[model samples]
Target: MSALQLQSAAGLLLLPALAWALGGFRRGVAPRVIATALALQLGLAAALLNIPPLRAAFALIGDGVNALATATKAGTALVFGYLGGAPLPFEEPFPGASFILFFQALPLVLVVGALSAVLYHWGVLPAIVRGMARLLRALLGLGGATGFGVAANVFVGMVEAPLMIRAWLARLTRSELFVVMTAGLATISGNTLVVYALVIAPVVPDAAGQLLTASLVSAPAAILAALLMIPPAPGEAATEGEEGIPTGLYDSSMDALVRGTQDGLGLLLGIMASLIVFVAIVALVNLALEPLTGLTLQKVMGWALWPVAWAMGVPAAEAATVGASLGVKMVVNEFVSYLDLARSGGAGLSDRSRLILTYALCGFTNLGSVGIMVGGMTAMCPERRHDIVRLGLPALVSGTIACCMTGAVVGVLTPP
Candidate 1:
């Protein structure tokens, strides 16, 4: 690798440590635990990045993204076929066949939701959460309840994840609340994975699985980072509750599948609406900015976030472009950013740059999300609005850093 690449790698590796420093790890028990976590994460990043087989696995993840896109497109086309619109001709059979993938992609959310329900019913998810909770408790000194909630965020939605520990919400300390918020920001619901994969699959081709894994991996990273930001008090543990998943009103597998399909449709509509308004707003902003500074959001991002992109180990020449992508992710939504990444049609970014972008845009930490999280969490725990408000920015910062860490780790392991 070039010197710049090496520097980028080093910067990416240090992001978690930097996040802790910025988030207030300079004093108390937090300092030691955060330091150790950073060290362990760095070591793990190095080891994983250097292994040949692991590198290949990540690359395969990229390919999986492409396959997922194809699947989503195909599903989309099937759904639209009934809408009676003329088929758009395509140069290749795959592209034409892939139309249904878009519609089918939404189903993934419901699939995950239903699967979560069943897992919860069968106690599988709880067991996994308990195991992860134990690790976080031992390593980061987080309360068991907080650790379980954080781990649960990986499989479920932000609002829903906390409900698993609903009984404890009223009693959680400030630091524990921060962990919950940060974890929510850092992880995406399993239900939305297919949709996000569909968005970026065209650009990165086969990145769906990788993006999914990135979100899952970032869950732990977010938890660790959040704990570093505000270590648990001297004698705190997450309040414990009876462990079991709620059995939704479904009698059979077919019934669950049917309900899941309907839920997926609703989610798909929400995503589409969100994307429409968000993109339109960005366009409006670009138009407004075009006259004053002769710089659009895209250009501004290129200039401002290039260093961050470089720090995450994107090639120097591509750093600005990747930075622009990161900026969009932070300022807007990951969905918008992923669409831009895929359709930018600027000179194509390097494979590594693409991979890094995939990781960076894998979270739900934009300004819009702050409202969603705060509103949703507050609604669940009406008594903790003040705590939620205070913890919001820190959660955003830690969540963003966790994503950046994932990008860096992926970049290090990615073959040049």
Candidate 2:
């Protein structure tokens, strides 16, 4: 293999490398599970991204995303009337000359959240979490709370994942706590799944599956990374599958619906506000840097992260272009990086680069999230506040490494 190709394969173990560097890496720590997960990710990526039968099965997820968006419009249209939808009473389009974030993406998140709550109350969601948790704990040798948190993160938000194990937070060791944080940041929540799908469905045919697949593959990546970074204290036996959404969280079915809507509103506001501020800050930075070296924020990001992208087996000519997405995902957020990738319009990008970028930018691993994790955990478990602060930077690093590992798997498996 070429040097870059070898580097791409090595990058698949990037998270382990970081964990080793940080100490606490046992020579015989779940080695079978680690190797299996890596192989599974690469094999899964090749199947979904290449094999006809598997691709068809996963592509249905994208179709479902499209259908859900349409369904969301109907819910919005009924409640919001004219303003919520496209057509107006007579004169102009309801949303006016252009699409609206409030009318579109936010409403989708709101509806998804409500549906999620309803599912939870019906005992459906917990059943799924328990099943995944059992499988992970068995295969990965994880403690109860950590296994559940890792599994729950795939379906819920990062902050909400720990809510699944509310009672265990204060008592969790630093190693266990870091796993919670890393897992949360390593995967995307189900609510944003549709929002992100909307951005790339046009360019990538199986957008939903690609996004979901990214999270699935990263779960093991995050687990192994956390284990290597901070070995759990000996004899640390966490609670069993009951580590899920707190009992009595919703009084009635209707109450669950209302609570979900409220939660979604908070998320909608945060996502919209973050995008506005981050985009503006990038513009400001580019303006300031333009005078000195003619380097915009994007160009600087490309140059800085080019090595990572190249190591992921991107074409030498287009490594910077792909690297820019990685840099943005780390510094800002995945939402911005995905938008940047969509803006790239996939011009001159090989299939491998596109697939790697898609997997890499599918998480919440930026610096801002460190504060979010710390603040959220503190509110839930005030006693462990000190531990959260201490593990913030390492959690961020671990999450970033996990996402890169998935991308590297895709790169290494694809033909050069």
Candidate 3:
């Protein structure tokens, strides 16, 4: 095997081993379960990425996503004028110099989010989720409700996905609950994926396809990580719930549009606020420490996570860069990390490193998401609130590991 492939192979083992060591119930971790999960993830990755026909279909989907992203400009320009990418009354200082992230890039989330809600209202998304859920249940040996939750997460937000199986939340075993939480942290919703794709498209070819597959493959990875960290006991299974998304999620297509728009607006505002505050906080910290240590926060984080990036097949010279991005994703959020990656245009990294990081960072595995996941699931089943809280951190860790596992798989499959 090639050197890079060998490194990626090692990462595949190293990540799961880390999960096993951190397992809450080590004795319950079954070898057969781990092997099956890993095999499922690898098989899916091979089919989605390595198979020619499937790859072509996904590439077409990626092109459609890019086109959809472009369609948002019409609305943005109408709302925000020249600042949102409309023709400037005055000429720019240079070509492509007039870009404004707030007005131009972030608004895409709002459009995509609303469209996703409309799709759900039309039952299109639920149909897709339902089919995928059955497939996952058969492949991963998951209960009906657990499988639906995992599948729903791929198309909807973390909180919304659980609503589909809300009836069964109180009855889920500890392991099942952990798996559900991990799946949320491990995958990105459809609306946000568009924004990430927009930021990453400049650096990564077929950014949309990569993001879509990363979310799809990461669902199984989440299950794998959860099983390793907290395996279910014999005869302990998830309670079956209603098999599909609840009909009352939206009153109608119009209601879906309005509600989705409001939700998207809230998300856009939150992201804006987060970026503003987190960037300033990092700057302040950097200012306080730079003179004493001659290193910034990113560099320190890079140093801390250097081994992880290197293990994922990143080159020695570029591992720190990849590590810094991973650190940002964990410390703050994936949005900030993708912004950083886009700003740098994936410079100082190989194609392999960029691909790996793209997959690695395609998750909601930040500290902030722990609270979100815990609160969302707790709200669904008030009786299980304590269990949700206890499992939150482990879910975060397991979910992060799952994302890295997906990256390692991509690295192994990627030609050097």
Candidate 4:
């Protein structure tokens, strides 16, 4: 094995150690749970990435998902015309200037969201989620609600994942709640995967499939991190009921489509508003900091995080750049980090570094998302709001570590 690959293998071990050392209740950490989670995480990554058949299947599914983005362009063009990738009536001063994210890319959430809802209503998505939940429960010995929530996060947003078990949120143990939150932060939702895949498509091969695999593999890592940070007290592990996942409420296929579209619209608006606010905040902060410190926010963060990136098997020359992207993901959001990744492209990065960061940055672990998680959980179970707030930062830590773990695994498995 190459030195870089060896470093990645070391990273797979070091990240969990970091989580354990940072754990709030060290004595309460359950070794059995931790061991199981680690084994499951490593095994899953190997099977999915090493085995040719599984890799091909995932690649095919990823291609199908990517195709969804293409189909969305058709709908977008009908509504948004030239701004949405349709041919412009007249030539512009600059090529590609007509492209508009609001018109061309964001509309994809609507299509994927609508399709996901329809599938859930038809029992397709629910069945798959339920099966995964069952397997997770059996392997990790998690509570039913916890497993359901984590599995649901693979296909839905953090807020939506807990919606399936909202009634039980107040009943979930502290460890389970942390797991749910961490999983949400670790995995990207299906509806938004298209947007991310599109952003990194220029640099990352099989972007859609890699994103999908990253989400799937990150769940166990998140669970591992959560367990280390806050293992359940004896007898508190199964506090919630074992009723399993609840049924969908959509009245029919058409109702599912309509409701999903509405949800997508809300998400689209939220994304736009958040981006505007956060980007402006970053710009203002950078402007202030640059004159005083001779450094921007990204640069400062890069300095702090480059060691972590290097430990994750990034080459020394590229680690600072990759670390900067990670800092952007944590402080601002993944979308901006990915846009930066796209901008840097081959000029500033190697293929392996791009692949590693693709997994690392494929998450919702930014500060903004912490607020979203807290508020959404608070709304669902007002009485448990304090617990939700208390666990928020720890969840962010666990989730961020989880993403790094996934990247490390990819680094180890991929050829140098």
What's the CA error at residue 363 for candidate 1, in Å?
0.9
What's the lDDT for all of these models? 0.70, 0.78, 0.85, 0.86
**Model 3 Cα lDDT, one tens digit per residue, 1-416:** 68998999899989888888888447665577678877877788889887899879877877877787678888888989999879899978986689988999889888888898899889898889889888877777788888899998887777888777898888788888888889999999988888888788889888888898999889988998888888888767555663645887888889999999999998889778877877788889889999998998888889998988888887888888999999888778899999888888888888888999999999999877777778778888999999999998888899999999999889888877
Q: Which prediction has more favorable lDDT, 2 or 3?
A: 3
Segments of candidate 1 deviating more than 4 angstroms: 1-5, 24-26, 29-32, 39-79, 82-112, 115-119, 202-206, 233-255, 345-348
lDDT of 1 by residue, 203-255 (tens): 66556566666766686678667766786667665555424334454676666
Q: At residue 142, give the lDDT of candidate 4.
A: 80
Q: Count the backbone clashes (under 3 Å) in each candidate.
A: 29, 0, 0, 0
- Per-candidate RMSD vs. true structure? 4.0, 3.2, 1.8, 1.6
How much does candidate 1 score in TM-score?
0.82
Candidate 3: segments with Cα more than 4 A from true spot: 242-244
Candidate 4 segments exceeding 4 Å error: 92-95, 240-244
Q: What is the lDDT of residue 232 in candidate 2?
A: 64
Sort by lDDT, top down from the best: 4, 3, 2, 1
Give TM-scores for every candidate, taking all chains together and pairing residue i with residue i.
0.82, 0.89, 0.95, 0.96
* Top-scoring candidate (TM-score): 4
Q: Is candidate 1 or candidate 2 better by lDDT?
A: 2
